[model samples]
Target: MQVTQNIKAPEMLIDYYKAIEDSSARMLEAAKHHDWDEVVRCEGACAVLIEQLRYRSQDQELPPEQRKEKTRIMQRILRNDAQIRILAEPWLAQFDHPFEGKPQVLH
Candidate 1:
């Protein structure tokens, strides 16, 4: 979608937040596979992409109705990114540190 110069930062921030999860997934996967190189590469890529979205994304945002979508874009993206990060963390941890102890059910 094309954005005008007036686009809001919050709206763009949502997308930037979202890309975090996508990037984290790649990081987690690479870690899972013992591909530390790939993990590092993905982290760099993700950082750049997020920076671009946060810093370079621009569009004209005007009219409440027109701005709604961008607003929603930001909200939804941020939410997704957070959830994905939550899930990815444990997965990444498991990959990074293996336990030789007997598995115990927490619940």
Candidate 2:
């Protein structure tokens, strides 16, 4: 017989936060390696996870203990994002004038 385990709502919400933190870490790693493509992929993953977290959070509230852990996870994610932005600054500067001489069209 196969058994399945059901996670509680608060736990599930923490899991989403952990997943997002993980994806943000990966994005930072990719940025450090100058792998913009992988960074973008990880960023997309983080976006999806964020959306899922928002949806799951609609009716779920974490308990005090889990809230502390979520705060830690959020802090890590923010740190990773800060590092990634620093790493990407040079690469992003390349697009500073991408449309400098292009004509603008209003729709």
Candidate 3:
């Protein structure tokens, strides 16, 4: 089999992108309605999905400074979330990408 066969199809990847866009839209909806809780929930869910999307680094070897940066990020991977969504909301909105889901509480 060719290596490309194991790779994800472009549309599947685009759907994932659209899901994220919809997720952002959901946040925008929540914000428009002044629903901070829903904003927090939707943004956090999208962040979790992005983390899951990361593939293993092909370049396993890193220079010393880069290694330290990677170590810091890896350490954060274990830390409990500390209400990061609050800070994240305005910043994400400033980027102006459209997301599309009707706002609803998932948990």
Question: Candidate 3 on 6-96: residue-level lDDT in tens?
Answer: 1222233333334444556566556566666776776776675455444322323344555555455444432312333554567678568
Candidate topping TM-score: 2
- Clash list (residue pairs), candidate 2: none
What TM-scores do the predictions have? 0.40, 0.80, 0.41
Clashes of each: 11, 0, 3
For model 2, how does the per-residue alpha-carbon lDDT over 31-62 read when each residue is reduced to its tens digit? 88898988888888778878988998899887
Model 2 has an lDDT value of 0.80
Residue 58: error of model 1 in Å? 8.5
Task: Score candidate 1 by lDDT.
Answer: 0.56
Model 2 per-residue lDDT at 36: 90
TM-score (C-alpha, index-matched) for candidate 3: 0.41
lDDT of 3 at 97: 57
| Residue range 1-104, candidate 1, lDDT tens digits | 11112212335454554455566655656555656666667678667766676564555324465466656655654664465466457657876757646596
Q: Candidate 3 local accuracy as lDDT?
A: 0.49
| lDDT values for all models | 0.56, 0.80, 0.49
lDDT of 3 at 75: 46
Error of 2 at 103 (Å): 16
